[model samples]
Target chain A: MFRLLIEKELREIIGSTKFAVSFGVCSILILLAFYLGAANYLASVAQYNAARAENLRQLEGLTDWLAVRDYRIFLPPRPLTTLVSGIANDVGRTIEINGRGDLVAHDSRYGDEPIYAIFRFLDLDFVFQIVLSLFAIVFAYDSINGEKERGTLRLTFANAVPKAHYILAKLIGSYAALAVPLLIPLALGSLLLVVMGIPLSSNEWMRLGVIIATGIAYVGVFLTLSILLSSLTQRSSTSFLMLLVIWVMSVIIVPRGAVLLAGRAVSVPTIEENNAKKGKLNAQLWREDREAMTKFQPSSSSDPQRMASEFQKLMQEMADKRDARMKQLSDRLNEERTNAQQVQRGLAFGIARVSPAATFALATTALAGTSLDLEYLFRDAALAYQQAYAGFMFKKTGVNLSRGMIIMRTESGDPEKPKSINANELPVFTYSERGVSEVMQAVLPDIGLLLLYNVLFFAGAFVAFLRYDLR
Target chain B: MESGQPVFEAIGLTKKYEDETLALDHVSFSVRAGEIFAMLGGNGAGKTTTINLFLNFIEPTEGEARINGIASHKDPLTAKRNVAFVSENVMLYPNFTALQNLDYFSRLGGKTQYSKENYHAVLRRVGLQEEAHTKRLRGFSKGMRQKCGIAIAILKDAPAILLDEPTSGLDPQAGFEFIELLRSLRDDGKSILMSTHDIFRAKEVADVVGIMNRGKLIMQKHAAELAGHDLEELYMKYIAGHIRDAA
Candidate 1:
């Protein structure tokens, strides 16, 4: 009986013109997402490679290693990030690594292209969360109440059919109908990626699969929501209007409202204020260090080499002391800011997760390694790279390279002749994505939330339908 | 079964909606095997409510609507299995073909063994055209849809059938054909309880006639007892409470 009902539902939906139209729109959007993502990823890779080549080219004819510049490493584009998007474009991609200083990333895609920010790319996440959710509502909002309004509900119930089985069959049938057609577009999009040579790793493909599964779960939430609303109402129009209002709140208003509310509620120190404080302390320390250096003249130092050696030792000691103080201040301020930001983010996302759409967005982003954590992960990778860089610079120049601290050679052997340093010998800065297992862990809670939503809505609809006034 | 063994019964059945509007009031009736009982009433006369109770679509406040002596509310699924229902308007799934609707409803009624040929024959028996068998119900007229509903009921082959205003939109020819069909069904020993406003048809075909007004069954008579009487006059008197003192 259940199978027959499912078969009927699939036929009914597939035969309807609305389903065909909506399905076509969904296919186009999904395909567009895949196409745009692949194109954007290709463009980003080219831009990233060009930037790296340019950085290396700037260090071409350096006479000494100490004079070598252009050591900026960029965040590499991930294939899945193109499809999911998340915060990949919003976060900065370029970080300049100077041996010792606070690193500030710049050149964010969104910052560079304000036009894209106005209406973000139509990624898979957007399509599933917004467009497909609406389609789910359209498919389900009138399922029960419309039957009642048409006088079919009473006729159906007049038989030996159990209400539970009927409702279950409806849910499963509609989900299968929607999901099975949707898979066609998704498969085509994936094939498109392969044809375009985006080169997704095994781990990336796994994440994409999970993301698609999550999108289905998110869609199930909306389908259940619509059914629940339909069962609770007497008329299809009333059910549809009520569901539309709820959809607007859950998909559009809740996440943004929660963030705004959390922002107003939680007080996180701004980046500018923290930077200003650090700058003020830095200048004060530098002035004191400069005075100490000027006061310490070598006593009875007639030898030029000896005097230079002493000056070098004195500069080294001062730099060490300044570096230590700066480290202490940076660590404390960064810890404080990080703590505040964590609290603020926790509050914001916690409230936003009340909506399954938000849950899906956050989950897909985490799985794709492009949530707010993307910025931190990029910076952390750059910092690790900076550690390696400092060691490399220390070995070559015998002096640590702070942002403003410079060392010049006053004993150039030949002023007219230029020598090129071995820039190719520099350590490669590689940023690896989070492993699939780690991503699964990060997204597990959201997957549970989505499942919970599906279950609760189904159960709610079941209960409401049991008590429904079929007459 | 014995002569008095009722296949369908409403024993002291009463219903009051949430708004405290009494839709049915202590109505007691029974239809034996092969009996054709027609209930006559005006609008909001609790005729549909009574059918709803018998189908277990709504619970009665006071008493039992029974099928085969089993209370409908006590074991609804089992009780409903022995009965088939055809609503007045016969609204079916618009997206489905006439044959599709019949197949779905028959399956719901526990008649999964019905084949396509069986569906076509039954639809023809109900006077629906072979050409319209595969046509979607969205384009079907009121009479056609009603015939489809009767086709579904026939396909169910249950012991009893409930019809609410079953002749409301039928043309005179179709209405007469429906009466003839009901007689054929009765000959096959299917108990039928129908609600209708057509007093003339009720007098013409019904074995027993019931007159209800404001949730109460004011008068009931066998066709033999109503042989020399005017059904319209009695119905008007019952609806207007002119016969209230006698009840």
Candidate 2:
């Protein structure tokens, strides 16, 4: 009976030209995203490879006595990256491995560029949260109310079937229809990833499976909501209107509203404040050290050779003190950013999590390794590598290293005049894809929210339906 | 089942809308098995409400309504399965052909494997032309829709059938032909309760006739008991003289 009902529902959905048109639009959007992502991925790969080749060529030109140390890192994109495109490819370096604070520096790069990243990505996250959710509303919004309009509900209930079975069958049937269009496109997209040479390990496959399950759960949430709304509204058109309002609130209004509220509650200091604070702390350290040296100089003996030796020792000590102060200032600035970021992420998640759409989006991104968390990891790694390279330059050559000028020569390279550094020495930025057990832990809250929504709506519908004036 | 047990029964059935407009009030009536019962009344007579109660489409505010010995509301599915109904407008799926509509409805009633041959037989019984069965209801006339509706009732083979103004839009000759068909259904032992304004049609075919006013069964008598009396005159007498007294 359930199978038959599912078939009927699928036929009804597919039979409508509206479903066909919307499906076509969705397919086109997905295809476009896939092409665009693939193009960007290819472009980035080419850029990094070219950079590597330049470094290699420079190494080849150097003399044997001169060792070329490289500090470039390379992290390959996983096969499922195309589906969720999580912060994996966008936030971290392709390759970087110089002897530096790998963990601390990786935190600063936080993915490559937010602008180029998905503000509204077209992966499973987008499909489940935005597209499938809409489809669910369309499918289930009119489930009972439409029958009432057509005078079919009375006719249907006039048979020998329990009302609960009837309503359950309707939900199950509509959900199946909703899932097919989403699953097909996603499966095809994953296959495309394989074709593009992204390796999918067993664990990644498990993560993908969870992503699909989450999608279904999210759809169930929307389906139940629509059913409940339909039961409450007398007219089909009114029900549809109410559902539209809910969708807009959940998908658009909630996330943005939360951001607005968070912004108002706590004003994050501007980048200028961050830089200025850093400057002030560094200056304070230098001032104290200068005073200490001045006192030392005044008391020193006037013997020519002894005075020269003391002057050299004092200069070296001053440099070390300057480095330590700079480190303290940088640490303070980073800590401030981390605190602000934590508050912002907390507010965003708290507000957006109310919406099933946003819940699905966050879950899918986490599964795909393209979330803000991964982006932050990449930034931290890059920052640490930079600091290590700066320290090396300061100690070995006495050259003050700027952020961009720090480079290394790889081993087995020429000895002299190698302008470009070896790519091999760069630290490779790798994204640690969360395992199934870990993903389940990460997404439990979202799952709970979605399930809570489902239960709430279904319960409302059941209560309302039991007392409904069937006439 | 027994002589005293009615095939359809309602006792003090009452309903009021949420805003408290009394649509049906303290209404009660019953029909015996295999009998043709006609409910005759003027506009706003609560005839439709009474029919709805029997079908369990709406719950009665007080008292009880039953079909074939089962309380309609308590066991609506079983009660409704034993009954068929044709409303005045006969709204159907306009997107489906008449045959498809019939097949769809039959399946809803738990009848599958409804071949075209079986549908044509029922359609023929309802006096519908074979060619009209393939046409969508979008182009159907009131009379045509009513015919298709009767065909559905016949296909269900329900123990009792209810028709709301079955001859309202038909020509006099067509109306006569339709009632004649109802007479044959009666012979086939299907109890029928029809609400109609056609007193002459009732005089011609009904075994028992009832006059309702303001949700009360004002008068009920066997057609044979009023055999010599003019039905139209008796109907006018009740319409003009009995409503206030019945209330």
Candidate 3:
């Protein structure tokens, strides 16, 4: 009996023109997102290689390591970022490591290319969040009430069909009918990835698989919610209107609204304010250092080279002292701001998770390693690389390269040509992505929330259907 | 299983909506095997409410509606297994062909053993043309859709059938053909309970006739007893609250 009901439902939906149109649109969007993501990733890779080569080209012909200036490290793009995108494009990718001061990332993709930021990339996350979820609503918003309006519900229930079996069959049949066809586009998209030579490691492949699974689960939440609303209302038109309002709230409003509300509740210092505080301390330290530099006296009967070396050592000491003081103030201010931001983030995401769409976005972004945390991860990695570069510079030049040092070359009439410094010896910067295990741990909660939404809505639909008035 | 055993029974079945409207009040009636009981009434006269109780579409406010000795509300799945229903509009799946709709409803009615030929034969039995059998019902007319509905009931082969205002929208020819189909089903020993406002059609085909008004079953009689009496006049008097005990 259950099988018969499910078969009828499948036939009823699959044979409709509505299904045909929705399926066609979804397939095209999914394939387009895959194609565009692959193309975008390729473009980013080419740009990154060119920029790195230019950085190296500029470093050629330098006679001393201390003269190396404007040496920049770039955050490499990952293949998954082209699909999920989260905050990857908004955060700065380039960090100029001066080897002494705070390493601030610069040259964000969106900052450089404002047009792309105007309408963001059409990625897999957008396709699933905006398009597929709406398709789910389109397919299921009239599942129950439409039958009643058509007078089929009474006729169907006139037999021995149990309400439980009928509702369950409706959910399973609709999901199967819609979700199974979606896999074709997804499989083709994955094949596109392989053909386009976007090399995804095994860990990345698993994350992608989970991301697709979460997308399907997100679709299920809308499907079951539509069915629930249909069962609760009397007329199909009324149910459809209610479902549209709910879709708007869940997809468009809730996530952003929660963030705005959290913003009002939590107060964090602005970047300019923190920068002003650090600048005040730096000015005070510079005044004191200058007074000390003015009091320096040369040694009696000193050789010219010896006097120059003594002056250099004194300057290095004063510079190191000022740097240590600035670092102390900067770390304190950054930590205070970071603590407040974390609080705001926790509260905002907690409330935003009420919508399954938000949960799905969170889970997929975490899997892709392009989440909001990407900003912190990139900066931290660059800071760690700065220490390595600073240590290497000290070994070669006998002074920190980032200490505002001025090298003077007073050449005699017949000075031999100095050998050029090797640019290849500079420490390479590699941005390490989060491990699969750690990403899975971060995504697990959101995945659970999505599943919970599915189960709760299905249960609501089931209960509503059981008490539904077929007459 | 006896010839006169009741296949559908309503013992003091009553229904009251949440808005305090008494839809059905202390209504009691039975449809025996091989019997055609036509319930005659106007709008809001509780005719459809009784049928709803029998189908277990809604729970009774007071008493039991039984089908084949099973109380519908207490054990709806078991009670509904023995009954078939045809609504006023007979709206089957519009996207399905007549044969496809018949095949589906037949299986839902627990008659999965029927073959495709059986579905074609039943569609023919209900006067649906062979060409229309495979065509989608989306463009079907009222009469064609009605024929498909009756075909599903026939294919179900349940001992009891409930038809709620089944002939309300049919034209003269379609109405006459429908009456003939009902009589044939009766001849096959299927107990049928139909609710309608057609007095003459009820007089012509019904073995037993019932008239209800404002949630009360005011008049009931065998066709033999109503042979010389004017059913229309009686239905009017009963509906007007003039006669109370005309059974």
Residue B174 of model 1, lDDT score: 90
Docking class of 3: high
DockQ of each: 0.77, 0.49, 0.90
Residue-level lDDT of model 3, residues A302-325, one tens digit each, is 587787778788888887788777
Q: What TM-score quantifies how close candidate 3 is to the native fold? A: 0.95
Q: How high is the DockQ of candidate 2?
A: 0.49
Model 1 chain A TM-score equals 0.94
DockQ of 3: 0.90
Q: Residues B201-243, candidate 2, lDDT per residue (tens digit)?
A: 9888999999887676778999889889999898889888875
Candidate 1: the clashing residue pairs are: none
Better of 1 and 2 by DockQ: 1
Q: After superposition, how far is residue A164 of candidate 3 from its true place, in Å?
A: 1.1
Question: Per-prediction RMSD in angstroms?
Answer: 2.6, 5.1, 2.4
Instruction: In model 1, state the lDDT of residue A274.
Output: 83
Candidates 1 and 3, the one with greater lDDT = 3
lDDT value, residue A299 of candidate 3 = 92
